[model samples]
Target: MSLEKIKTVTLADVSINNKGEYGIGASAVDYSDELYTYLRITDINDDGTLNKNDLKSVDDVDAKNYLLNENDVVFARTGNSTGKAYYYDKMDGELVYAGFLIKFSLDSSKINPKFMKYYVLSKDYKGWVNSMCTGSTRPNINAKMYGNMELILPPREQQDFLVNILGEIDNKIEINKMINKNLEKTLITIFNSWFINFENYDNSKGMKIDDSYGEIPVDWSVEMLEDYVDFVTGVEPGSKNYHEKPEPNDIPFLRVGDLGSRDNGVFIDPSLSKNKILKYDDIVLSLDATIGIVKMGLEGAYSTGMRKLVIKNDNINQPFLYCLVKSNRIQRIIETFATGTTILHAGKSIKHMNFVLSDKKTMDDFGKIGNPIISIILTNLKEIEYLTNLRDTLLPKLMSGEIDVSEVNCDLELKYNYMKYLFNQIHTPMSKSVV
Candidate 1:
């Protein structure tokens, strides 16, 4: 039969999203910037981005066979994680899938790679997963099942058209993320130089002196962390109060899993935890399973496993405080506060933590440098949130044919152009600011 005559296709068809292989069953090692990232089911979020919180890597002599390329998609094959899918983007760098994941090489000529990934994440696909994964002891689907799954095919040109539209939005989001990552690295570099190494001290102001933590500029004094900041403990509010689709009064209730920009995961009714409300620029740290992941740039209510550091005033530079918690020194100390082998808890013990109170002038100097870098990171995060919301709103509509590809009047183009404008406005100044 002629391909043009077909209105539906199985994913297993080699000319489509095929070339299936089960992932390498190797155990994960620590994540290294230099090594290929290990993509496990746990490493993918529901919306199909890498879970940045606990990403690990693998180093093996047979690594070449496991390496993934662009146009590849992976499926989470077992347990409750079934039906989750992630497609490799060149932006994500090199990755190798772990066991419990299934990989497919997507052929763009037959199907849009991004489209296929989105399809698997669709309500239709989820309904299918719910139905197919039932009656089994646990939800499990193999490569053969994935191959047999069907797609109501659209013409190649239409698929391309849809991919072009949606892909641009995702591409912009990724570019912003990459920009933010570079900006953060810049913050760390300056932080290490000015604070840790004392490399940038103007000798006219002060000289290095021995402190409990190696050497610091003469005028700096160490103080209890509680003096400059107050740690606000979050409440459980219970799983019954959780809301994935937040109503008007519901705020994102953060968990350890949400260390990624303090994100769009579970929301909670704010009335349940009114006093625990968090806002932008608030610093939150995870103390349980993951340990010592500090992040800002979110608005929500936090869970008990996390702590929101309340700044008393400008005495502790906010950006300085942020980088401080992320520092290896503070991080090590924070880990010691935890008491469990399986799930650690820093909890109320944060009160016992000591803080290095840099001299006022140095903090001000560092803040001037660090603030903009952090501001850029925070701004990029906000923009990412916005772009994600836009894509999410459009996705189901687009996938279900509610919004046609010939959407000449689609506001997505207008909004997308604005996103690009924001991107262009951001990159140059941020790059120049880092030095």
Candidate 2:
């Protein structure tokens, strides 16, 4: 925890260069196996992680010049995303960063790149960024300003210890995220087959009928969403009432922003928050600003920009309703209803939207299968929240040296040796195959 031996140096002293190389100009080409991965500012999440699925590709011509390497850090230097950074690792593959981003390659002998990444998340770094970005219409941090920023560098050993512990926590969170993503993809495929395409239905038993919307099975019918589900807009407690840190009994205040972000939104005092409490499988739709974007409930009070969909009738399954609202068809319908040129709203139009509905028995059948998947997804989300909180809790303490993690390396070594011993004891080899 001692700062007596620490060195204070400008970013340029520890990095390979003061300014990052500009990325390739123009839009990314279509995704092709032959093309290199093209990384943009939008592809990097607020948490500094890359969204692999949303990435595009660029032609190989001069693309190698922009290719990122392990330990390289890319910073968003322009627009609303000024000062945002993304650290490249071995797993990110061959990727080229965009022009708006400035890459800072650290001198490993002087400072650990991973540790520098975490430092950027610290209050001091954020404060420095804010100070440099004052009173500008378009906020931008040029390469020279970035390189001139001062940083407090600890000894190599201390930096390694902090990075190892934080990296382990990050790896676990990413694992859970991947699991939830796969589960969602699987659930949607099942829903599409049974409900949308009617792939599993027996045509011999199903009779075709004509309706105003389209042809449908005689057993199926169409209904306005409001007929079976109650839609309630979220509340907006002024910023004064919001709590920066969560209270013991307070619930998280969900906003349209927190829909898919890793970090949960700010917490609100339960006593003061008048918004309807969301539950598992409840549908949440972004009705203001970013219209038509939908999310499933994670048990929080939503913000004014969102609407919570609650099932008023037992015949409609909650999971089905969630999928229905999240579908492209519903999104399109909601978009058509959206009003306003600058800030769109969908509350009025969404109320009267109609969708083809299956019979109660069919819904029940889908629920039997989809509910378990939804339950697992919700469980994963809860785990992610717990891990995220744990990491957040550890971050400041570790950064400030309030907690001495000097012994963490020793503890990890002992734990790993014990695990290896257990594996050797339990995993004995069979002399012959039973088959």
Candidate 3:
């Protein structure tokens, strides 16, 4: 690959306002919920998508000038995350891009937008961007600096071919995501009907029953959470003795952040022994900063941080219990129990707090419904992981002309059709009576 053949494209040439200043001034208007979504630096995902949760709304006219459109790529032009980019594909209305971000669009005639997105996210580009970043305290990149960076430009046809191949894989990943979302909605619906709304049986008159907690359904019984399970806190191994090579190869260790955004959970650096490991189907809950965010460990050994509550599943269906702990009511209970002055934190003794526990039959029934949804969620997650790996593996190879696309005849169109069929088939009603 000849570095000389690759053309240097500047960020300014492709941006809506190439000469715009780095940060928005104080005159920038406040955002409103009823109006446009405001995109901040935090809203940009590492993988080139917008994080909807971080979006706010702004009504200012000056801020609206930096508004994003479909196909616009917003880059974190300033701050510690400089050069991180997001390709905006969807927006309800006009969105204001925070001053910390640089907004640009690809010249589609010369470059494939999707290809350019992945290229910027590649290690080579990020390394270059990192090196070019200037500032002693808060590093930042200007449009001029970004525009001078060179990139490999495969012919338009080859660019399209590569983009199409990777795009197909991404399409499958989205399909899997949608499937997982539908599965979650189904589980949530079931939970709300059975527990929250009490739609499982007739309750037209808002009936009540007596139990340990006092008022409850006559058919339902309450038991303390401590009666069914024991909660254990996580211990940090400390950064001093943390070894990367030898330890990570053996036992899996988890951190508070390892609980993935969409998936079940992730392992941190692993240790040597597998014996002192957190196994599959164990319920792990966050106990600090952001409390009570619960997830089940699907694989690997994990660290039991002081902020983590490791629930020992003693015949209680782990999935069902996880759902219960993640419920709105339980979250309220956790919020009330949390203690702090500035940032409220979940207390260390939250595990000792007692809550009404449903009977074994009820828990098991809920488990039956939940387990399938969990299985589907995990399966879709694994599939996305696999697709991501495949795409990453092929990206550089295809771009560098090492792997010729002509030689490979994988039927991406057929795969996409099959993916759509599978997605629709998964949530189909089992019977007409059920619907």
Better candidate by lDDT, 2 or 3: 2
Worst 10 residues of 1 by lDDT: 426-435
- Candidate 2 segments exceeding 4 Å error: 17-19, 25-35, 52-61, 212-215, 238-251, 260-272, 297-299, 408-435
Summed backbone clashes in each candidate are: 0, 0, 11
Q: How does residue 295 of candidate 1 score in lDDT?
A: 78
lDDT of the structure predicted as candidate 1: 0.74
* TM-score of model 3 (CA atoms): 0.79
**Cα misplacement distance, residue 48 of candidate 1 (Å):** 2.4
Model 3's lDDT to the true fold? 0.60
Give the 10-residue window scoring lowest on summed lDDT in candidate 3.
Answer: 426-435
Q: Give Cα distance to truth, residue 96, candidate 3, Å.
A: 2.0
Q: lDDT tens string, model 2, 113-223? A: 899778877777888988988998999998888888898777777677768777776777789778978987887887888777888677787657656556566688878
TM-score of each: 0.84, 0.84, 0.79
Candidates by TM-score, descending order: 2, 1, 3
Off by over 4 Å in 3: 1-8, 11-33, 91-94, 133-135, 202-215, 241-252, 260-276, 306-315, 341-344, 347-349, 352-354, 406-435
